[model samples]
Target: MAGPRHVRPGPMVEAWLIEAMERYNEESLERREAYAAQVHLPGAVLQDLVWWALQALPDEILVGLDVDGSQAHQPDVEAAFAGEAHRDGLFAGQGFVISEAAVVNRGDSYSVHHLPEDWTDDLFRSDRGNRGGRFTHWLHTHPNAPAVPSGADADAAQETLGVDMILGLRFSPEGPLPWFDDVDGTRRTLAAPEQPRRFGRRGPPVLGVAPSGHRIHEIQLIAFHRTGLGVNVVLVDDEGWPYGWSQD
Candidate 1:
């Protein structure tokens, strides 16, 4: 008898596979968060980062940033305020700035592959050192996808003690907008998580009418600690003015 023929997955099977993968990724995220560390980022930095990520839309890209902050059992309002007052308190407890971003060349269709080990080393060596804030975060874009961690993402994140962030981008005829989220490597809990309006879901049903008018493009942002703690993300303009929340 001939061997069984190879068959492609049908739509239903494909959907099931996608759902299964999503569930697996979510569970993996939960496991990683259980031991993740906490991080705080400025709204302005986030805004700029997302905008940059969106520019790479239809293709994924990698970004690196220097993080400045000290560990704290709880968020220190004074430290945060002091940092803001001096513009140098980012090294203070629970206060951070995601600064000095550099876009990594990942070639075309980069999403299908991981960063080369040599490239990762080079990025860190060139972008971080004793001269400035340490390379503390790895951010990437997920065009037209939810701001959720993937299995591959989880695996790569294991290589760092720093935070891993994902910027989700979905474009409308209006323009390119993106959402951001983080995956913790230390598994520590965060004190606050930003909440923002979501777009991208289908419009509400109406009798004899299409819901095109109700359709809205959305951008979502979130952050999580290794211990499954959600971190708040504040989106701001270049000058630090509030733009929106990252969670709900």
Candidate 2:
């Protein structure tokens, strides 16, 4: 009988994953829910990268990359973080990474600042020439908010065919109750309600509350396309094990 294979991620990647998972495991339910709302990807590797970036940086960050597999691509989709700027920002500006080592010029806010037409053209050309893959996805962080798309996010998605991801992270000392088996003996945790409890045009808040005296933090990840497609991101460790939350 053959033994299970062990795949090793890079040193930096492994370090980041470990730190991110440590923080995630210690976070409160509100934080986990925030993470659940926005982060999704096709594989554990990508998810780990997203988680690491979200936890390590204090402000917003961005990662751009190309996909290396098909839906037929199977259980594994290789996210080739091949460009130099596989990670960028905690910066004041926004723009795609076009070269192996492109650095976004400094701007002044969480939102991506506008770039000159000529500068953008040059970067686009560089990306096309040096980076062998198309810029297929962009992941960013939201310091202390829900993972839901903002008006600006929506508008930006319209300009590209790629998916946009947001990771919402806010930390607090309070925590939620630990998961326990259901009384029904189903061995499952509680399920979310299927229908609204009250009658109103807008749906009730999907967010959950912590028990009295318990503190909370917020972490969420969500992805959307301009065409209205939503992607679910699952966080995992370097070895592809699920973390913090369950896929089910």
What are the per-residue Cα lDDT tens digits for candidate 2 across 1-248? Answer: 11111123322433333344434333322233332122223233433443443333343444443442221111231132112222222111112221111112122223442232323444365434222223455555554445666666666565444566665544332123232212221010111234656666442333232322212233455555556544334434433333444435
Give candidates' CA RMSD values in order: 15.9, 15.2
Model 2, residue 42: C-alpha shift (Å): 7.6
Q: What is the lDDT of residue 32 in candidate 2?
A: 33
**TM-score for each candidate, following the candidate numbering:** 0.47, 0.42
* Stretches > 4 Å off in candidate 1: 1-38, 69-95, 107-113, 116-134, 173-216, 226-229, 235-248
lDDT of 1 at 150: 70
TM-score of 1: 0.47
**Clash statistics: count for each candidate:** 27, 19
Q: For candidate 2, which ten residues in a row score worst on lDDT? A: 183-192
Output the number of the lDDT-best candidate. Answer: 1
lDDT of 1: 0.40
Give the poorly placed runs of model 2, Cα more than 4 Å off: 1-58, 70-110, 113-134, 172-216, 236-248
